[model samples]
Target: MKARDLIVLVGVIGIVLMMVLPLPKMLLDILLIINISMALMILLIAMNTKEALEFSIFPAILLITTLFRIALNVSSTKLILGEGDAGEVIKTFGEWVSQGNIAIGLVVFLILVVVQFIVITKGSERVAEVAARFTLDAMPGKQMAIDADLNAGLINEQQAKERREKIESEADFYGAMDGASKFVKGDAIASIVILIINLVGGFIIGMAMHGMPFKDAANTYSILSIGDGLVSQIPALLISTAAGLIVTRSATKGNLAEDLSTQMLAYPKLLYIVAGTIAMLGLFTPITVMSTLPFAAILAYAGYRMQQNLEQKAVSEEQLEEEQQIEEVRSPESVINLLQVDPIEFEFGYGLIPLADVQQGGDLLDRIIMIRRQCALELGLVVPVIRIRDNIQLKPNEYIIKIKGNIVARGELLLNHYLAMSPGYDDDSVTGIETMEPAFGLPALWVDEAMKERAEVSGYTVVDPPSVVATHLTEIIKKHAHELIGRQETKGLVETVKEQHPAIVEELIPNLMNIGDVQKVLANLLREKISIRDLVTIFETLADYGTYTKDPDILTEYVRQALARQITQQYSIPGETLRVITVGPTLEKKIADSVQQNEQGSYLAMDPGTTQQVFQRFQEQIGRLVQSGYQPIVLASPGIRMYLRQLMERTMQDIPVLSYNELEPNVEIQSVGVVNV
Candidate 1:
């Protein structure tokens, strides 16, 4: 039988048992049956739909516990009546009522009822969601078929076929993104505004009704009721609903007005409930309208507040402007142009060596155009495009013809000329490889001085790397007369600075890579402007993971450079720096290696995409960095920060890693000083 049919049968049996069978004489049995029925109603609804069910279990439990406690107290109080108890019980009950216990009982009862209403509404919502899902599951199969014909050769038929099948199979179920609780900002604000207005308006209405000034009315009611009673409730409800309407209306671009109106149509039912609750109070009690008004007002306001908060959140113009600026800052074209290659023909890791070697830069232009087209298709965007406009020498031994373009959908394309050099890239692994490349370019440490200044200026939480250890690095290159030009330096400290195999460095010529920071620092140190001690202090002071200390400013430059390289290496957008911004042992070594290996004036800017990707890749890279005798430090988000702090504290007590969160707002610092071996 259907679940609904089974429910009906059970209900009928329950009714029959109530009338014909004496299974239990206690009222608790009846209450249990009622609870079961209520629960079943909720279960049926949720089983058929896809909405999330939110239950305030604590409130419900408290309400129930209080009611039972009151009941037991009252029952025990009646036990005081003995043989003359019949008359005495009645007299005592009357006395209790006369003494204002009745008023307290009524207040408790009202609160419990309100809680019940909330629970019921929540349960009904769950049921509706489940029912909707069940309805979707009942759709016909042929109607779900893919629109494309496999016989047509117009597209990649195999891929098309698979996509269609996947879509069809998943169509029966709603995606997490498609759920009704997709909250918006405008809705939330609207709801809150409306709720506040209702509260204020309710008081005004009560003042008018009581023939007193608003302030006097409030004071008077505050005495009789615990606070301003339900007299102000109706207006508050109206106001809150109106607020929700305004917010939802704005967010939906007026598409949701009808829904708001439909919800408002339930006001009459709310009124009935309110009226009935008021009427249920005893006439002989000292209960005043003032005492009950606030509760009613709160109840009336809650619905509007909830609806508004759930649906009306909006994105402001300021946020949009910021996003646009960020987009400009991270323009893939800039990163790609740094590498100096055409984007189209060279995407997907193909034709790299000859393209990089060829100087004219004409044969690669078509490939750059193709990349732009592909990005347009993928992200479905139409933003102004930027392309790599210059030739960037990335390293002495390795160079890529790079191209960059802005597509409408995908933001910026950082096309690397070296993809043509990497073997074994397929369609699936393309994005994966691109995502990983950025992590390799992160810096050993990121400084957040700019972020701190911005935070002070804006009065907002700053994203800066936490202060842990104070470390620095220095590299010195000497030009001596009479030295052979080809003289090889001994296997020096740089070999140990970065953990890569010496063989790999020899073959890859990582030293030839153009990383400007290392060169600049070295130059400054050689000029005696910055001491070697200061360099070591800077290096050692950074978080162990190089740039992952949750400090945005400190990591931004390295992240930007990494983004450039990642875009190039992964997506064939060539002008990426592939930087890693971190303070861990491994990251510090990488920085040292970059300084030691890279030629002067060879550094490049990375795309923003690579920076974000590298941040994400830190976990995996930490292990590699550590295995090479390099320690890493990682940053934490708000929720995880405390736990991470504790774990780090325990692990580093012996090694002495320091952490400080009070440096600047929203920025924490953790660092490990290098051992002077």
Candidate 2:
């Protein structure tokens, strides 16, 4: 065993032995001073711990210290009664606290008992019990979140395991603390009992055995009892306070002093208010000027200094940013850097800067964070960090959205105005500048504050500038989501699946298919606005069919059939019949025959005349579906579904095309219209 380990084992045994052994005055005094010093060290260590887990051994330490103090008490009691004196340590404590008055010393010792036992110990015990219960209750939820992140490719297997372990440690620590607190409580009660016995027993012994008078016996024993109690109880008080600090400590980046100063003195304005209030007390109240003036001046000085520091910090950050930009422009690798592109980018003109600037009340940045979370939940796609910047070449109110460094959509906004779409019919009184809502291309007007309330009352959909921008950006991302995912992103998803469902990934990847093949399959599903969130089922389907075919198109069809329930839920109402446009016998037969195969893959080889005919018929059916307020879903047979989708993908990319096999058996499908040539 290690020396440190052996020393700890021996020290615990020695603490127990100290209760039975008799000691000389000098040796006893050394032990008593060591007891006080250890207690102070424990308190300092507790104060410096950033979290309770950082001091996980505190419960064991608490038990050992309580035992040590109890042993010291028993030894002192024996010495005071048998020898008529404990030690120089006890005698000095007795004399110093009493100052020749035993009654005052008794009062002081009782007060320490009340503070440690009733206040600190009781509070610490209750806190430990509550913290233990809460930590256990949160365990399942924390574990589920870890699994979710692992599946989402947000964290690796090792990270998830570490997080789970930390949660367990938290529960165990608090539970141990709950039980160890009783030791301190029992020690407090024992200290009071021991003090009473020492005083009473010593008095009787002094008169009966030593032949002393009542006055002399009482005087001699009272000082010894008070002194013993004071020495023991003071250290007990310190240990109990340390226990409270450990139980109440939460996870923080810094120690107690740093957290207290950083959080409490965070707001300079609050400090200024406090200083002014203290100054007013001196000016108008009965409090003396000298008493309040010094404190008020100190507070005022602190606030002023804090404000200056904040301004200096802002200036330093701006200078640093400017220097970095200049260095980047001057470097030879600047051209290489320019070749890289962000997955998504949002650039706005000067007039719309406030929409991204936090100080100007812009919540655009916060909304984008929510947007990423929403996309992750809905589409099972991890949207990258959106690079936002200002473009000087654009108009003042103009903003553009980009995908892979190419501009995809642009819109203008008046930040102070609301975009109000009309309620089927226009109200003559509600008026502003005419415009178009960019997301859906609906006719709308930019109305100021005065017209906003009136428009809402008139049944118009009133939306602020930020909401307009957010809605447009969300739609753009959803439309172009397929372009954002690639082989690297697919590897992340594959690795995530390997953490939990290893068998499926190992069977399919490298042997039957590779990362690029999987990426294509996922992109194909996302192109039609299908969610890839249920990756387990998707991987299972791929593993079952990947050996038979290498085509992503064929593989996506198989995967879609596996996710029939999810796809059905996406398009079908709970009880209502699914209304769709069905391909007629003539179109299906033509599409089936037009599907030609080659070395690369299959292609629709229909002539222009037949293709134009099919397009016109589709337009007629889709227009009617839109007029009737039904989504335009093209339902076709399984064999020709892929071909039919390929024919219309370029012109009607937003519309969903479903195969009959993709629908659930329970859903009732009604063909509202049929398309044929």
- Highest lDDT scorer: 2
Worst lDDT run of 10 residues, candidate 1, spans 467-476
Model 2 alpha-carbon drift over 4 Å, by segment:
1-17, 53-57, 134-172, 278-286, 306-346, 352-388, 397-401, 408-598, 601-677
lDDT tens readout by residue for model 2, 396-429:
9999999999999999999889999998899999
Question: What's the lDDT for all of these models?
Answer: 0.32, 0.92
lDDT of 1 at 135: 40
- Residue 467, candidate 1: Cα error in Å is 41
Best by TM-score: 2
Predicted structure 1, TM vs. truth: 0.19
Error of 1 at 457 (Å): 43
TM-score of each: 0.19, 0.63
In model 1, how large is the Cα lDDT of residue 650? 32
**Reference-based lDDT, residue 153, model 2:** 99
